[model samples]
Target: MNFVKRAGMSLRARKSRTAALLGIFVVICALLLGGFLLRSAAEGREAAAQRAIGVDVTVRKKGMSAADAGRLGALDVVHRYNPRFPVRAGADGFAALTSRRPAPGGARAGGGGPLAVVGVRDAGLLLPFSYGSTGITSGRGITPADAGRHVAMVEERLAAENGLKVGDTLRVRSTAGTRTVPVEIVGIFADPTRDPTGAAPPHELPGNVLYVPVRTARQLGSPGTTGEAVYRVGSPDQAERLHAAADTLLGAGSFDFRVNDKAYRDQVRPIQRVGAFASLIVLVIAVAGALVLGLLVMSQIRERRDELGVLLSLGERKWKLVGQHAVEVAALALPAVAVAAVAGQLAGPAAGAALPGGGSQHRRAAAADGVDATVPPPDPRVEPADVARVAGVGLGISLVATVVPGIGILRLHPRSILADTE
Candidate 1:
């Protein structure tokens, strides 16, 4: 019989051994499927986080030390800055005044409340972008033109609660000193979560925040120190090198900073642990499965010592015998790998659905500043289509797993089988 026919016959004759080897191949394919899915999911989550933060790096004071925070503002790469101050309620503090129309009998108006204030030197840099849900909800954003105009931008919530609107005037008193400034509400916005990091989001109809130019904020005696140094890199990969260079130039611990790279920070220790553990486990599993498969195939070869002897005596070359066995294993293992890959793909969506806030019916509009601390929606990470691509890769791994053992079969000299005289 020809080499092809001989290979087919060998596969058919050793049903039990072939089945055992196929089982091992199945396990290896499964490991690859799981690892790829998790890896894709993690990448998606980090991408979402970066989008929300807007900038690639953030430098803040390590603690509540405003002095240290201000020092960061002096860095060469520092592009923007904000200084926070306290806004309180009193004669010179934040005050709300209500007006009662002219009545023959009486009229009344008043305002008072504790308030939190943030001071900014560069309003343009403070809100680099306009971030809001459904576009600008009210008046225009804060600008340098309003620097000394005593103008303020108020979120929708703050406006409604205080019965204030665009063109309305309110008082902001300084907590440190008895200084009050009357500022007009130039704009109303809608971000419930307003992050001090940057422009706040306007997801909710009314945001609970307010803004004023740096000049007006400083007048309130809440002049905070400068600010931490910050940077915006082009890509995540660039973050690491840039951070290292920055440290070299700025000096370690001189300023507090944050970079988006997965390495360098201990905060991502859990994710690192998971990835490291997964890699180690996958490696061990792959090798163990391959060994089990090799053993089964080797055992089958031993059992067919007599059959192999006859084939060798008939002038069959060593490569021909090795090729025949390899083809048989490929036929079984390749299909198993394909099936596993498809299954993994299909299962990915279901897994994503199980993630936290996954498939949430309510879409929360994110602010430009608030970081996306949660993982990204899982479906985008590993779609069903990815399964086919991964399966193809798994097939290559499976092929290598199977073919490697066949080398031993090739090394066997025909003389050895004939020496047995079977």
Candidate 2:
């Protein structure tokens, strides 16, 4: 009789053991399928979060402090924070970007309007920088980490006029000449925005603009005095939270907490975190599944020593004995794979949302920033590829569990096996 046919008969004879192993295989396969489905849903949620990051809000208060800005930025709902402090400063060495012709009324003497130096925590979070209307031509823009540092991003045309490059130093003095701050040029940006009427002040020229750290700007004229605090939040819900926080911190009826529902393109950091977690689930289940099946198969091989000896004594080849065992495992694994595919399809939606950054998390990303509507969670459909992946992992687990243990028993002589059963 063919080993394949014989293996089928043997499984029927040991119905209890065969049913137990089949149940275990089905569980392992189901988890593998669930992991793949969850990962797909996470990717969809991340895409939605990217689209949702543009909702913005600005809180304007008189004499807002740096401490207040820092505390507001620390909120999880705030995606990006920019505290703007615009001040006029006198340039020491470099020439400001000026018009060939003076103002129509002829500019007043004494160079009253100094260069415009704006202080910020994250320059990139500002309007011009975030929208690409203004872009860094060289080096990197100032980030939140540059707080308290004397780093700055010089305007492109202004840097070229002074023959300045990154790592060069520029000097700025307060309008009252009470204090001077020396700033290191870490980046140079270009802006096409110009005074259409050419009637703007010298300091207000687009080319003469300078971006410095928030702390550095505080030293120019006002200590801890910011013009306004702007934030990029994922939803209107987050914007409301910011409004409440600002009222508690800056007091009520004094500040203008305005929320702009317009979408602003920014970074989606939480999506990356969600993907990492899905990968961890896949890895943990795969490793544990292999270990469990291996131990069970090894124990079964030891108990079947008498059956193995009879097969070998009847002229069945040692390799065929191993093949029969492999056939039995494959028979169970194939059915389990089918069962898992069905189970995953039925349970995918509920399970996907249950994952981190999935269900209620989707609500934060669902609406059009301010539009209150319930958006359905990303579909975690069990695709053909996902089934294929689970199938491959199941076969791999079976190979390791059966082949490794079978090889160990196959090495013993048939006489040694028969004598052991006696």
Candidate 3:
């Protein structure tokens, strides 16, 4: 009979032994598949977090003139540039408001103060609104049409305190009280910030915050008061490119550029640690699988010593005998590997979901940075590539485990093998 036929007959005759090896392979393949899927999922989450956090550069300095703003805005690396003008402004109705409680040193109540008045090019795309830390609760946000006009978006609490509503005109006085602008309330937004830490005066609380058009802010404040210019780069990778371009265009020492990616970094650290641990698990599983399967194959060879001796006596080539053993093991392991692939697909998502801190830490960090915490995280699913990788590893494991022990057949002398069996 051909070596292939004889190998098939041997496997058939040793039904219990073949079944035992198949069971071991099924367990090994399942572990390998699970580890690969988890590592891939963790990496996927890290990328998603980075994309969500976005990349931006803030230039903080005095004397960032309109010409500098125009130059930075015109850079190829800038997706959008928001030139901010922040001033302290007291609204007409809320000036008398004071915190309900007095301070520790008998300081006046918190309520009577000027709030931060921020002027922006686009109220909708401002960092706080864009990230969802603050959302419009009534009416609409400021638009380009509102530029140069005394339009504003007030916090919901502030509006309630002043009996203000959309379309109501708010009288805002600059910090110096030198000029007062009548800003029509175009919108009211919900503030995500909690109550003021006792450290902040009442006027500095979330209720006092307001958003106005940049032109109007310029009109109310000093003629040349310029705040930070924030440039949004498309990705973290492009942050440095934009910074360099801005530095060259604005002159080396004109201003300082700083990248804000702390939120992304904080969110990704835990996921990366999880991925590293998953990788270690994969390595251990592969090594242990090889050793366990190798020993099993070796024991099977010992039990079939008499049969192998008979075949060698019949002039069967040692290589052909090894090939026959390999085919039998591969045939058994292939089916188990296929089943493991299916099992992994079903189990991968559940395992990834169970991974601790995948979403919670990210949400907390996002909330701290005024990012919307309600956005759902990416779901973990086993992709086709994951299946292919698991299958390849499983087959390699099977070959190494079976072929290494099958080589022992070469050293067995036909006469000695038959005599030892006897």
Report lDDT per candidate: 0.54, 0.77, 0.75
In candidate 2, stretches whose alpha carbon ends up further than 4 angstroms from where it belongs are 1-36, 39-55, 109-113, 260-422
Higher lDDT: candidate 1 or 2?
2
Taking all chains together, each candidate's TM-score versus the true structure is 0.56, 0.56, 0.70
lDDT of 1 by residue, 188-245 (tens): 7665443334222221112433567666766765555444434444345556555565
Candidate achieving higher TM-score, 2 or 3: 3
What's the candidate order when arranged by decreasing TM-score?
3, 2, 1
Error of 1 at 138 (Å): 11
Candidate 3: deviation at residue 49, Å?
Answer: 1.6
Per-residue CA lDDT of candidate 2, range 1-422, in tens? 79999989989999999999899999989988888787777777655654445466788888887788879988988878898988788888777776666777785535434588898888766767655467788999899889879988988888888899999998888767788889999999999886546555677678788889877877876655776878877776678888888788888888888776643221234555666777788888888877887788888878888888888888889888778877888789889989999999998887666654444544454332332223345778888998999888888888777788888766967898898775
Higher-lDDT candidate of 1 and 3: 3
Give the Cα RMSD of candidate 3.
Answer: 6.9
